[model samples]
Target: MRNLFFILFILIFVSCKEDVLPKPKAYLSLKYPAKSYKKLHFERPYVFDVEKNATVKDSKNNWLTIKYPNLKATIDITYRPIKNNLKELLIESEKLVFKHTVKAEQIVSNDFINESEKVFGSIYEITGNAASQIQFHATDSTEHFIKGALYFYTQPNYDSILPAVDFVKKDIVRIMETLRWKD
Candidate 1:
């Protein structure tokens, strides 16, 4: 009976012995291919280089969406004729960008001027958990005005979507640099 008790106690003690270890840290890694751009000649008043990875869909009335299916994001482009409303359009565009200031950490504005091409505007890069990461307006300062905003389909989790945001930002910059107003 003593030997049986000793065996039972040994088994219980051995079974109770467990190694307490901390879990290893984990991180997400995403990889995207180098972007190849193609000149997109829209029937509207402008032309720009679009990444081949994206598909462009006409929304209506010269408005279009450049969709990145893999990234679940889009660049919404809106075109407007500058009648007597250049002031109004500029005000509206700036207002649209500032609307996210509540959630944005900082809004950086970059002036884009192509005097030879007659395109001039500002690109706003909003950092933080804002609904839109990038917003831009391009105009001939006389006749044509175009604005664009980059948005993700998912909820605005800045940390989680930083990679995709950066990828799209480069594309937006390329578009701004290459944009030409049609005659």
Candidate 2:
């Protein structure tokens, strides 16, 4: 009887293990809390113009950014004419970051250099007790920029919401990768 019980338990365990599903695959992934949200759209000039859904609002009707909660995680996805060029855009963007992040610790700047598409941008990560990240992507037709920020109390740095950031970044990349200029 003892041997039969042990065998039965082992079989059950093995079956359960086998039935477990593998982790979900994605361009990016992050852990986050459960909540409800809605999408929003913002209109800028030639700099960035696109529809931004998946937004949360506070009681005061202030826009709550989905990517980062602290500094408007709101994404400004737009297309601009290549008349200015990437070099000038880079300088202007750097100046913007410096002006805004006066109290922030500049994390680092990253670039996505593509010979065929000529896509380029920089990502700035700031650290304090909590951290926030920002990015600026520019092309000839238009520029796509996003400022992602999170409060210290929100999550423990990258361990918690980093995956979500990555997941959303992937989504943004997908959107950019398939971007088409409206004639």
Candidate 3:
């Protein structure tokens, strides 16, 4: 009886698991393609550079959807001719960005200015589980205004998709850098 009691005590102590808390969520690690860019060929109100691997869906209203098939992601571009609504357009763009504030851990903005090229804009990087990880708006402040948002086809898992967001964020910068408003 004593031997059996000792074995039971040992089993109880030895098999005790440190509280089996659920495992922390894990993110994916991925490989990306080499980077190269080409000028967008479609005739439009503006011209910019895009990743050679991406396919663009053009709309009659001058909006564009830059699709990355492998990543199952897209960068949607919206175009507006700046007649007299620059302020309104700017506000609207910011409003669209802030729509994610409820879910975003934080939103960061980086201003892009190329006075020589007449391209001025801000790129917003939203952290956490926001629907859009990156967004931007660029303009000549007179003739053209363009806003872009990044989205993934799958659910928004910010950490898992961060590398993809970063990959496209650089492309958006390239777009802002190479932007030229058509006359």
Stretches of candidate 2 off by over 4 Å are: 1-72, 84-87, 129-132, 141-164, 180-183
In model 1, pairs of residues that clash are none
- Computed on alpha carbons, the lDDT of every model, listed in order, comes to 0.93, 0.44, 0.93
> lDDT tens digits, residues 1-183, model 3?
999999999999999868778999776668888889999989998999999999999887899999999999999999999999999999999999999999999999999999998889999999989888999999999999999999999989897788888888889889989998889
Regarding TM-score, does 2 or 3 come out ahead?
Answer: 3
Tell me each candidate's TM-score.
0.87, 0.43, 0.84
- Per-residue lDDT tens digits for candidate 2, residues 41-110, read 3323212222243443332222233333442344433333446465665576667556546455545665
Question: What ranges in model 1 sit over 4 Å off?
Answer: 1-21
Query: What lDDT, from 0 to 1, does candidate 3 have?
Result: 0.93
Candidates in descending lDDT order: 1, 3, 2
- For candidate 3, which ten residues in a row score worst on lDDT? 25-34
TM-score, cand. 3 vs. native: 0.84
Q: Residue 9, candidate 2: how far off, in angstroms?
A: 46
